[model samples]
Target: MTPPAIPPPGVFGHNRSLVTPHYAMMPPAGILPSRLPGFAETVVRFQAAPALGARFAQALLEIGAGGGTTAPRDDGLEHFFYVLDGAVDVTVGGQAQRLGPGGYAFVPPGIAWGLRAEAPAQVAWVKRPYEPLPGVAPPVPRFGNRADVPRDTTNRPGRYIQFLLGTGDLAFDFEMNLMGFEPGSHFPCIETHIMEHGLLMVEGQGNYLLGRDWHEVWTGDFIWMGPFVPQQFYCTGWGPAAYLLYKNVNRDVT
Candidate 1:
């Protein structure tokens, strides 16, 4: 077998990590892995957090086979998990389910949950303090695969969206969605919205306009957009570009 190619030695190297008051872009090449408490044989890279001006935290987790939490985690926060590859067994409130690629789970606050990898696995994890609304009960745990969600293509040609969680329910304070754009497609207009967003590029490449600057992003990159920061995307690869998006909704602005 031939040896793997290596880059020529250089005095300096470049990376794609950017941060501003309005948004942040964290490329996979700039990831810094660390171990988290309660987990074994797992590495975590946090993409967004309150320290970075984000209201929530999102992390990428890489788990070795048979590795997992020592006990159920119940931290009084809502949690969302999306499997990117391999298989994982997830337990929520004593109920267990096996999640493969494209699988996702939503655990509401107060529920105990844990996960163990059936194989080497990569997962996206999001956690935030639960915001309760008067007269509206908290949402229950939800689990499903992206394949089961119907794609809504009526918005625009070459663009589609899949809502991982129900949108019509008032009990839900936030939503996670899978948005896809065929090559050469773009958002209808630059969006300047009240909702802050945590986004993970899951497929292909795109040029993202965030708060007046355009950045080239690829699969495995993560972004966090603050509220009212301008944002848009234009697909620019041979295949479709897609992202997993998180946005807080269904609550009044204080």
Candidate 2:
């Protein structure tokens, strides 16, 4: 009889999770799962929060079929939800819409909102306190999908960007965007800016420069960049790389 084949080890000797004063690189493999108060049958991995030096909170959620919020919730905080896979029904201010992959919705502060998974689903959730600007009215609830947004390729070859939320209006204090890059493409220069960011890698792989270190990141990874921390990205692999980015905008420095 042939000897029994050995199975591979289940545990690795090391992990890739990294944290710094300026940024954090959290791969899905190293994330600790948790539950949220209003959600059921879901796994939540919070990537950025005030405890991590970020003004907003970002979480990646995996919901089982038939699982979601127990009831509508309103915490006086604005929210943005983007579906990464499967199907979900999101309700904002008593209006409900079924969202599939790449679908997204934004709920303004003080409005009631909730979600229910029609199938097993993955989603990115962002929450932040509304920053009021004098003479500017607060933004209203909006919903759309990535397919509906036009990609702007005028910046350069192999690079494209989509502003999911209109940036021309001052009433909007934050922005969510989709950025894509072909293999071997990269940012024109290292960026150091006032706006902090919560970025979720949605597709392909890349080398991301955070502060002074370059880290290999792939799909399902999440990065948090604090204000003025230098950052840049260089795409790798055979296909394209893309990320969903959240940044505070249209507000004066306090």
Candidate 3:
């Protein structure tokens, strides 16, 4: 196990809430499942308000057939949703769209959106406060099914990545991406960077280096990596492994 790195300075606030341990790993056991109004059979793994010491919230939402959110209400936050399995009907700003596997949608801050599934489905949602930039408003909601999102090979042809968001000016401050690695593929030696991360294992299993220890992460596991923390991941199972990851981007150095 490698030692943890010093977190970056100037966290979103000088508030004490951001200072927890260097890393967090939430297995299925840590999920205190809940059923809130408008949400049926959903388990929010990390709230980011406390547990993981992050500026965003993420959850593994399991929706039963004919169950979904009730109404659209803006919560002053930006959101990203990706479907891992089954099907869903996501309505963003009054437009209803049907999504199967690899479906994704992004709702900018203050935008109304809702979700429901026809069959049992596993959907991952990541949310964070809309970080406003002077003179620029957040982009309108972007929705699409990523089944065709081309996978660009990483250093190795077998390690591939697909970004659900557009490029250049259209790119939002945060990103949700899907990464796939063939069996035996490995991550970079170690990464210590400014962008923080929230990752959900979507397929297969791998050993991931988070904070000061390496954890064998399988499908359904969740990880939170604070800024400047060392991170790495590798696929060891006979089949390819994949995960949906979130990271804050295009922000100030602080």
Candidate 4:
């Protein structure tokens, strides 16, 4: 849908310097507190589940007060979750861990695991079975919070952005990073690469050109694009629009 143009942050004119057009590429969509017994808000996009592209599958696990999910067995898919708010207890790969806001965990395929909310927690998760190659077994589950890691920015000239690596112990074909876009900033060109995307807005509003359509999105919205869709965005807010973005990295070409 073509979103309405929200006036730039605050008043116009001389005070304009204080006001800025806010914009951001968000993390996931429909990530809200849940009414279910064991889940809260959640937004899980296709980019995070590359193996389950547009499938009639349940990619997100939302929990509310006293909410949670039973220990599910391998459905031939990998499992990953990042906490956004509150906390939740996760049991994966025979290990139990309590994840608070900013915490994260990943369960490899074939390993049994379950999840439950502590109070009210928001988590973004993905389900895609590990692609097992000959002589290789699935890796162990991983757990941690944002504070447990460091922010790594891609030192591209003229771009100011910060991100964090998962455990940095294993190599992932894709990277999910918290992206930032300041007022009046932009991703210069329509990125048309082999990588697909699931951009979720965590904060701010902006204009995004996806394929041939210009879409305006705000916090809580999501955009999924197929490979080579030629998409770009412009930030029009005072504060930078920050969102957890997912995209394949170090991918192979045909």
Candidate 5:
């Protein structure tokens, strides 16, 4: 479904941003509240700090056909784009690729990447600056469709996960991956982590622990977390619950 264009942020552009002292909940009331430059035929779920108390930002962006970014973009932040519906063409680092649902592209910091919507498309836009490691080599651009990637459900029998970039050699300061839970399944314990998160629900429904509250979340919902915010999930809907997760990694305590 092609999403309707949203009003751009006002000249003052202050109200769209907010600071959730503890946590925030955005149920599927079908409202996307924030908008800024660098997009077209798109609506944003939310953006960076003061609103969510996080250093990084993630937005649920929907682009209509023939609508996309204004130019090849490179903002010196590592970025990832995961397609949720329709199709898109991305050209980056001398490589151009077309992605349908479940396709993803990773462009490392400073690489030129451009996007065009062939069909109306919804995407998860995740961004954060790289925390450089002195000895590790710089990362490279990678493009792939998740259908071709392994879910590797062996060790994790009933559940499924296709790790897009959580591994030994990826050399990134953050991790972005896909996770699924069978209906009625849940985490055994609450988890507290130093890495903050930006989670976008792609499918199903569930109750999630955020800070001190449990909020109902379903497809099209986005959740942000600051450091050590208590978190966990329980799937209660008719089908599996799945989400694309973004979390900072490979960094140290200040």
Candidate 6:
């Protein structure tokens, strides 16, 4: 009788599962800790890389402790924020807004925005330029929380996550989603495609395969993957691992 292959240690084992390539996974890069005034005891990062064919840009994100605030600084990219926990006061384009868990806000490029905290708050924000189409005007800045909006699943089932395609009403090269993975469940497939990704694990723990490495990620962990990086996930922590997943999807050039 033939001997069994020495599979890897993860629950999924070593053999890579292949699918129709709905999306590609990238090897996530870890960001270091930094401090800013009003943002003391906070973690900040600008996650961007050349391996993913990403143009010159930055992703300004932050996770904060109790009573932390982020002062306004200009990097000149359109800003978007999603609040993971707690509350904060955000002034965008001279307008004031209060953001709570699941909250979101957009700050126009070149516009001045300031952040202040009333309690403990955790926020994830991204900055991109307002690209113009031939005839479409740049969109007005939008602000709200995830709870205020309805969670939409994909057209097909079994992926087990809420889907929000930013391209639904705009022109872009990516689709952003809040992926909710149930504990003890499985992704079951090694996704390979052309898209790059940024996944911030908001809750729970899971074994994730990124490129040639299998990583265990928990809450407050950020995962950045390059294009065509083979990957999958299996949740194992106390609760489901909910992450904010950003994927670079091809969009029409007008």
Q: Write the per-residue lDDT of candidate 6 for residues 1-254, one digit (tens) a residue.
A: 99988755532543222222322232223344466555555666555544334432334445444444545556676666777777877777778888888777766567777776656566776655555566655555667766655555454233355544355665543456777766777665798866667777777878888776666676766556666778888888777667787775545433
Native-to-model Cα distance after best TM-score fit, residue 192 in candidate 3, in Å: 0.3
Summarize candidate 3's per-residue lDDT along 48-160 as a digit string, tens digits.
Answer: 44455788888778888887785734588888888888998888877878888888888888778989887898788888887788888788888887777888784755698
lDDT of 3 at 50: 43
lDDT, candidate 1, 1-254, per-residue tens: 99977765331395567899779988876778999888988999999999999999999999998887847455799999999999999888778899999999999998999999968999999999989988878998889999999999996899999999968677888899999999999988899998889999999999999887889999999999999999999999799999999998888877
Q: What is the TM-score (0 to 1) of candidate 5?
A: 0.84
Candidate 5 per-residue lDDT, tens place, 32-60, comes to 45655776766666544545677877776
C-alpha lDDT values of all predictions: 0.90, 0.91, 0.77, 0.59, 0.76, 0.62
lDDT of 5 at 144: 83
Model 2 pairs in collision: none
Q: Clashing residue pairs in candidate 6, if any?
A: 26-225, 26-226, 27-225, 27-226, 28-224, 38-69
Model 4 residue 146 lDDT score: 68
Error of 4 at 117 (Å): 1.0
| lDDT, ranked from best to worst | 2, 1, 3, 5, 6, 4
TM-score of candidate 3 relative to the true fold: 0.85
TM-score of each: 0.94, 0.93, 0.85, 0.70, 0.84, 0.70
Question: What lDDT tens digits, residue by residue, belong to model 2 across residues 127-219?
Answer: 999998878779989999999999988966899999998776888888999999999999888999999999999999999999888899999
* TM-score between candidate 1 and the true structure: 0.94
Q: What value does the lDDT take at residue 29 in candidate 3?
A: 52
Model 5 pairs whose backbones collide: 18-51
Q: Candidates 3 and 4: which is better by TM-score?
A: 3
Error of 6 at 222 (Å): 1.4
Off by over 4 Å in 5: 1-19, 28-40, 47-51, 70-73, 154-157
